[model samples]
Target: MTVVQITLRKKRLGRSLAGDIVLFGLLALVGCFMALPLVFVISNAFKPINEILKFPPDFFVRNPTFTNFYDLYHLLAGSWVPLTRYIYNTFFIAFVGTAGHVIIASMAAYPLAKRKFPGKTFLFTVVVLSLMFSATVTQITNYMTMSWLGFLDTHWAVIIPAIGSSLGLYLMKQYMEQIPDALLEAAEVDGCSEFRIFWSIVMPVVKPAWLTLIIFSFQGLWGAGGAAGSMYIYSEQLKTIDYAFSQILSGGIIRTGPSMAATLLMLSVPILIFIISQSSVIQTMSTSGMKD
Candidate 1:
């Protein structure tokens, strides 16, 4: 190669390496910042009460112990209800809520993504716009409606609303749009029913999308306000793990160590779920809605 070409190539390579180093450094900083809370949760779970209360509390555990977990067990052992009951209630709600939401959202999304129908544009527009409104902003109105429908203090109040969530619908619709229209059209020509096509064809192809939805739905329902709030669920048996965790936190200064343990326990499941399903989520999210 010419001397000028060799020098220019070396300069470009050096600049590229520098840019990469800077980019990765920034990413590492952000990752550490994001991980701080998780590290704190894990480290503090093993810390003693004194360490937790120590001024300028250290982020890492100095001397770890299982006493906190032992104390947490004994504390919950004294509760009016068994700890298993709270766990059961949380899982029941999470599973049912996630299943119902996935089915309904996928069904609704298929029509919006694949069909030409009356009011389709308007309906989809409304769904998109609804995402702008937060639940806290509409809680009063929602509660009033639920009360009028005699859904107050019922599990239905939580499950029904979540089943129709806009986020799930939006994600499913965007992903469904990526499915080739020609395939669906071919299925129709073979006399395949729309419902059959959706269940047997579309649903199978969009595994990544629904897996993403599953992660979202499960995490949301597991930590839902309805599960913990006294207004919607008054029955002790119906209250979830989140409510039990709140009770632990309210146990005051003496139970602070256990409370940190409880927080980590609560966080672990969702973190695991995301870690397991994150590959699918990233793949689908990156390319969804890009098909013509």
Candidate 2:
């Protein structure tokens, strides 16, 4: 190639590279702006009332302390359960709920998506319709059922209902539909049990959906919905993090720093999980509903 031709090619490639760089830089800047509130919460968690309240609150802490953690423990008012127990309860509920959501919901969805069963279409339709319903919308009836089952005052009330979520089932069913019929038939010919095929074949193919469900279940349980049954369960040793935090904030006037500190801790897990997992989740979901 001539010298001028080579120079032109190099100039075009450089300009293309520079444009891509500018595009990614703008996206990163937007991401930072979107994440700024979480940054504020984390900073406030380590700060005192004065710093958190400044006219234009600083993202950097002036005087950080472990006082808020201690202050939270004292809010129990003569209880012996300790703050750690509350964390344990929260973690237990979150872990079990997330696992149950993935396993049970996927199991329930697979047959609906791939197998013929009595009322299968009707069942899927009902589940899809129910996706629009929130727990708060059915609280009165659900609470009554809890009373009937003697589950009203137990952790099971929250855990059990959370496992019944339709959103996970719907998403899983949609993902399951993407798996080829030939794969399931081939597994059966090779003597794989239905459960084994689902575990090894279907589940592997929908890993992105599973990860999304994991993050979602954790996020949802960490929010207000998982705390609804805390009214019945928060008897000292049984309190979840949300109930404990609310009880602490509601008792007369609280110093803003400690309250904000507690709030930050309450919200930290989901924020961190979403930030870490957002990319892979989007990619998986984008491809999950397509035909084989």
Candidate 3:
């Protein structure tokens, strides 16, 4: 190669490196900006009541204390309903709802994605259209349906509705479309039943998609607190941990520290779940092969 060509190639490489560095720096800045609220929550959880109520709030706690956590424990302990009961209700609903959502979504998505059938286009269109409507828009309809089905004032009211979430179904369908038809065909040629193929082959291959679905579904159900159940569940014993914490938050300004502590405790579960499965979530989002 001539020296001039070599020098030009070197310049291109330099420019590419500079562009990459600039992009990385910008992304880092944006990430930090997004993380500020999370950092502030963590900081406030450790702050003393005096610091929490200071005129100008400090970003970091100067006098860290565990008093908030202690207060939260005592307050909840004094409630008529046991703290363990609230915790049990929350976990039961979140886990059961998330599991049902993942299974139902995946099962529905598989056929819509890989098989040709009558009304497939129309059905998929309905799902896409459903995504445009917020849960609030369908609240009255859902309540009526639950009432008709005799599901009102029960855990099933929350679990059953969450199981049919359109978002999870849509995401699974899109991700499943990326799986090659050849794989399913091969399984069928070997005399594998549709259910067998779905459970064994398709499910294992689409692990990332469902993992992402779990994160989304669980986060929604977890953060929903009593709102999802409030309309259906009137029994105090059936109330979730979030509902209980919300009571603490409503206890005037004096409960600010404990409220912050409760907020952190509530957020910790979802954040931890996301951290554990974040790689799968990223993989599912990044590797889609769907074509318009």
Residue 138, candidate 2: how far off, in angstroms?
1.1
State the lDDT of candidate 1 residue by residue for 61-125, as single tens digits: 99999888898898888889899988888888788889999999999999999999999999999
Measured by C-alpha RMSD in angstroms, how accurate is candidate 2? Answer: 5.5
lDDT of 1 at 185: 89
Q: Please name the candidate that would achieve the greatest lDDT relative to the true structure.
A: 3
**Positional deviation of residue 28's Cα in model 1 after best superposition, in angstroms:** 4.0
In candidate 1, what residue range of length 10 has the lowest lDDT sum? 283-292
TM-score of each: 0.86, 0.83, 0.90
Highest TM-score, which number? 3
Task: Give the clashing residue pairs of candidate 3, or none.
Answer: 153-232
Name the better of 1 and 2 by lDDT. 1
Tens digits of lDDT, candidate 2, 1-292: 9996899998877777679889999999999999888877777888776776787878878899767666765665445667777788788888888888889999998899889989998999999899787777877777787778888666777777778889999999987887899879999999999999989989978888888888889888776433564554646676687777766677654556668777887787887888677887777666655354
Question: What number of backbone clashes does candidate 3 have, counting pairs of residues 3 or more apart or in separate chains?
Answer: 1
For model 3, residues 1-292, the per-residue Cα lDDT tens digits are 9996899999887777778899999999999999999999999999999999998889988988999999999999999999999999999999999999999999999999999999999999999999999999999999999999998878889999899999999998988887888888889999999999999988877888899889989999997766964678888899899988986579899999999999999999999999999977677555644333
- lDDT for residue 200 in candidate 2, whole number 0-100: 91
- The segments of candidate 2 whose C-alpha lies over 4 angstroms from its true place after superposition are 1-15, 56-60, 63-66, 73-78, 229-231, 252-254, 275-291
Off by over 4 Å in 3: 1-20, 282-292
